[model samples]
Target: MTKRSPFLELDGVTVDFPIYSGGSRSLKKTLVSIGTGGRIKRGGGRISIQALKDVSIRLGHGDRLGLVGHNGAGKTTLLRTMSGVYEPTIGRVRASGRMATIFDFTLGLDFDATGYENITLQGMLLGLTRSGVAGLVDEIAAFTDLGGYLDMPIRTYSAGMLTRLAFAVATSTDPELLLMDEWIETGDADFFQRAEARLKTLIERAGILVLASHNLALIRHYCTSAAWLEHGQLKAIGPVEEVLAAAGLSVANAALAGRQSFSNAQ
Candidate 1:
């Protein structure tokens, strides 16, 4: 096969937010008047966070893309942009298949509700019909292993309980594209073992799986290709071994490291 073009394309993308040291939000009363039209429409009010910069990427079928970056290097922003959470301030994002993003410990979990109730709520958020959640309720609750606690309020559950429920529900449907950021942070070794097994199954089913994490071993073993992103741009992109070698990282057989790749970007 000659191989096909990417199912998704992002060319010359950029996202920027102003650093309102003064009162940009209150500037309406201080500077520009109402309906100026020509001036930038930041907001009706002020203070902002410049979360992302000029970032661009492309994804094709069978691409297990890994995103590596520092704490605020815009990994989450890029993932959100890819998933249509936040529209790009510039450039374009064209994707062929449906995209799903799994960020945060219990992103859509309702704390006031029972584990059972939250599963239904999360399924609804994932766009699953009532019958869909009802069908999977038993499965998700069983995997969570919270026993009868499934009937208790989510606020009573620990972070680990919430994580298990979230992962179980999200993976049950097998989305076309799966985007994740540090998804396994809430479990013990035994639970992680089970979660890892589930993740492997998920990767096998999805056409594209993109994950961003500081976990080196996870990236090397799970992802076939990795991209080092810094200052909102891709520094290096290639096979796990090649990119890690260029960054002077051993990544040992079972080791992880910090974002020591900025030197190579210069």
Candidate 2:
């Protein structure tokens, strides 16, 4: 049987951001950096960051794939590219669904707007219509329970309040594909418990999920399959158990070995 094409494809994607040493010269420095290494060394920086390089993946209808990598190993970059936040410089991407993403450094809130207003703005940005956003506004505000605070500007709210409101809105949106950089774990410990329960339900409702997380237990328990990312490419892609073992993260063998060693010592 032939396998279907993934809903999202990152075909040998590569992206880079330029680095410059001097900031004051502006357009004048452009000429200097192009002509000579000496000028560039003096005015432009010697190094640059390659955020993503020749990375590729395919996410399908049934894929609950976990992305594993060290920090700066392109995990977040891959998620951002897939989410349309960062376009690939050297590759083609084909996407075929409405997406909901949560990697918000600050939950992408606007300070000038009320929690109620910001939810509508962000929801529309996520592809919802006026009524679609309106219908959810009440639900979001009620769930967050900011109460009269919902009428106040977001700037006046606490960080935890902002996160709660942001998460409430983002989670309430029903998207075909869900992209999570890190699972939502914000606010006080009490709020965290509620967020986790919501997360479990949200994961079940989505058609496909591409998660990048350092929490292995959550990855293993939730993902139907797994992909191990190292550097800028996939190291292993298969059934959750097999790929995890190939990544040297399986705990069964380690536990058995420890038991044997302990017995021998006794």
Best by TM-score: 1
Q: Which stretches of candidate 1 lie over 4 Å from their true place?
A: 1-6, 27-54, 252-266
lDDT of each: 0.73, 0.75
Q: Local error of candidate 2 at 260, Å?
A: 30
TM-score of each: 0.82, 0.80
Question: Against the true structure, whose lDDT is highest?
Answer: 2
Q: What lDDT does model 1 reach?
A: 0.73
- Clash counts per candidate, in order, are 2, 2
Candidate 2: which pairs clash?
21-44, 21-45
Off by over 4 Å in 2: 1-6, 23-25, 32-48, 105-107, 250-266
Lowest summed lDDT across 10 adjacent residues in model 2 is found at 257-266
- Clash pairs detected, candidate 1: 25-45, 25-46
Model 1: lDDT of residue 262: 25
